[model samples]
Target: MSVRQLLYLAPIAAVLLASSSVVNGQDGVAEELVVLTDLAGLGRDENSVTYFKASNAGAYERFGESIALSADGTTLAVGAIFEDSSATGVGGDQADFSAPNAGAVYIFTRTGSNWSQQAYIKASNTGASDRFGLSVALSHDGDTLAVGALGEDSAATGINGDQHDNSIDNAGAAYIFTRENRTWSQQAYIKASNTGRIEEGDQFGYDVVLNGNGDTLAVSAISEDSAATGVGGEQDDDSAAEIGAVYVYSRDGADWSQQAYLKPRSFSTEMLIGGILFGFAIGMDESGNTLAISGFNEETNRGSIYVFERAGSDWFEQARLVASNPEIGDGLGSAIAVSADGNTIAAGAFDEDSALVGIVPSDQGIDDQRTDDAIGAAYVFVRRGDTWSQQAFIKPTNTQVNQHFGWTLALSLDGDTLAVGAHFENGGSTGINGDQRDTSAQDAGAAYVYSRSGTTWTPRAYVKASNTFARAEFGSSLALNDDGTVLAVGAPREADGAAGINGNQAADSAAESGAVYIY
Candidate 1:
């Protein structure tokens, strides 16, 4: 039942070996593929594996659903939004279950080759169905952490405000935690500043990101229903239903303040009638001066990404990017990432149908394939001074329909390296460089690495979990260290009995418990 697969790219001498299972690429071709074994069978040469689960986690706890890594690769934050922990705050008892779905986050520290749990975090005002830790982000130094609770029903706003208020349903909120020495404490609480009377269903903290220095934070409310155009606009406007909004906050010394409220400038009666989830995805540069916001349902689901730049204390819209050959239902901005320096950006179109491989010309028409749906693609954009240009079109070598290749993305500090996740990829082969041709493993998922030289990008590696199983969703979430040397892939639906580092992955041992792998 276990096999080691080896794939060799002859020209590069880069050998990819899998543990439990082996899948070979095309025969006689320079690209000789190798598939490795399962997580329990990985060799010493393979990356060390660490499995994480809540101490009292149940079958549907989903411990590794969201993951964030420090720039130095020494610290990690994992989110378990479905964790039914009744305990509130840090280091509380984990067995209490009075509050169902209150959610929890786990912090881990790595020393040498061993990783250990450092802290268990929960909302200061933990309540039933709050769903804290739905999304997590760590500062470059790993000292500051941001946790989002998209299902939180609080009606509070601003920093450290009242969290007990639940007059609004699913209004959402985010928390900021700071670590000094090795102890962590709640630093601030954030909510939409412009949330007027009808604040229900805003889902303010659906996604969050922090700048490298942790001085700036960006949060998205994908269900924000305001027609506001810019900073401090009329937030009470309900004309735009689910148009979405992004909020930017800046820290001064120890205090954080709402800096700007961002919305697309194309907002109009027609747009308000058509816009949907404009801020579904967001990314910010290290300086916190540049930002990318995606409206995946814009233009009849063709999707668009908006770029914004900061000047003094104001943020202004810089550019609105769309696929050169825009097609309906392409979902071009479903996922996005920006480099540390704000010079590079990547946008994913998970529903793209083009079969073209590697870099495609920006002028290429959308007529490449009409039948191949959801083949997926990612586009890289480079900034020269104030002008931005599309630099590359990237795809996996084994691109196939419905793989959702760009469902998630992570970029290195320099933006020269990128990791793309295809959470719906169907390949029975497990581990790295496995046979991507097989479709037996439904939703097993895969990740791809690409390196950039000048303006060209080359495929570097194909990654997957050692214990591939149907619906494990190995590449559902991804995070890279500062230099892209360390990558963490999350399989939130993994059904393994494994609890902690290198445990047994017995078939059907645990269902939907989730797992995380470091490579």
Candidate 2:
């Protein structure tokens, strides 16, 4: 008896099919992995020069930033953050640092394939240096938008706007805008209670995600009050600071309020020990009740992931996951993505150690040291009974070391499909051929797709944009739409063109700009 092998295809369309189907023992089915990128079809303008195609489409550049999508996937609700000329315009000097950042939100309705700018929302009280539209997130239904203003001082926290001021007094804030009667309006402004203090500059409300109902919200403050719960601290002045945390807020009728403060469960001797609970990223469920948060720096050069559950309407810490293999240097959970039901979780560990390929002879063309260094990997966990356990631990079957397994992770709502990125993989480009030690292509990156069959999991495809330029680092960031039909990966260092798009050409050095790939 022989075991059938699974066939994996190019990651650009990670489609997989078994040599023989287990269900029928003789049938073969096609699998798919799609790639998308903004660099492909975009109109360049002074304000929105660099357009990105997220699930809905995203545009951000020097002058202004806008993100909008229609509820039906046909229309878009856009928001732009730019300087208000009335308060602060692009002064005569292009290098002038005195200009302020204030912007507005808009709602655009699209019909067929045609989209026209619908409404322009100017901040209610535009001011200098107020970058109102710093970040934006839409609900599953695309009816609600959450925007962050990390520079806003409306709550008058002690932290002055002085760029040189070292005081931790600025508590960042967020605004909720809803669409009613085809018009969008401000719904709520989120700020931690007692908004002003030296602890405030923790940059709260930097990133946000909303459930379908837009009632429950999760906000991340990479730097909040370390003394407060759910916040992480740091040691002295090494600059690897850890004042991080996240807050969960709930909405009742029209009133939105903070419901819980989430932090990692740790056994630390000192409150300032900085061992655990440095919140950096967060995602929530449809009701905003269930939450997932990432502490990219839980341990020196390592990270952890935390999950919280809401009982009825009360939110509480539920589970904490450090990589099952607790190697001191592997920073598991550096970035995370959670499903709408909170039942599925995907985590990226960009610095995971690997030994996938050991040694193969020269003429054979199988390179030794292929899986060396801290190549990334991703882990998946699913909820069962009252406990959650690892459902799958996936890395590309042919991964090389230093590929950075978990550069980014994404799981669909049903938990059936998963995507893992290895931003440093040598995808058959270098003449060195499949050797993990072959940095010939240098920092070239790649992504992998996997699917589950009952309790078993298999690699379905390996993908990289066909035009992916060499050393492009494409897997640094990834986002997957709920059904897993669309994926967006950021290779910020890639150049802008077809031939040298991904890692086609060696980088000028290691320092390069970034780009987002959509699939």
Give per-residue CA lDDT, model 2, range 1-519, as digits (tens): 000010000011111111111121111212222222232132111122222221111122111132323223433433334433323211122223233444444444434433444444443434454555544566666667776655555653222222223333345667777777666666776765534455435456556667766777777766554444433223112222244567667778777877666665553443245533355556665556668887665665456777877877666678887666545456666557676677777776666664432111111211212222675556677777658886655555554656766655656566666767676776644111122233355566766666666866655445554334566665654544555544445554455422211222332332333344333
C-alpha positional error of residue 376 in candidate 1 after TM-score superposition, expressed in Å: 1.3
Specify the poorest-scoring 10-residue window by lDDT in model 1.
4-13
Best by lDDT: 1
Q: lDDT values of the candidates?
A: 0.75, 0.49
TM-score of 1: 0.90
Instruction: Give candidate 1's whole-model lDDT.
Output: 0.75
Query: How much lDDT does candidate 2 score?
Result: 0.49
Off by over 4 Å in 1: 1-47, 196-199, 268-270, 363-365
Supply candidate 2's per-residue lDDT for 289: 60
Those runs of model 2 whose alpha carbons end farther than 4 Å from true positions after fitting are: 1-135, 149-170, 181-183, 194-200, 228-243, 265-267, 275-277, 357-372, 397-403, 422-445, 466-473, 491-517
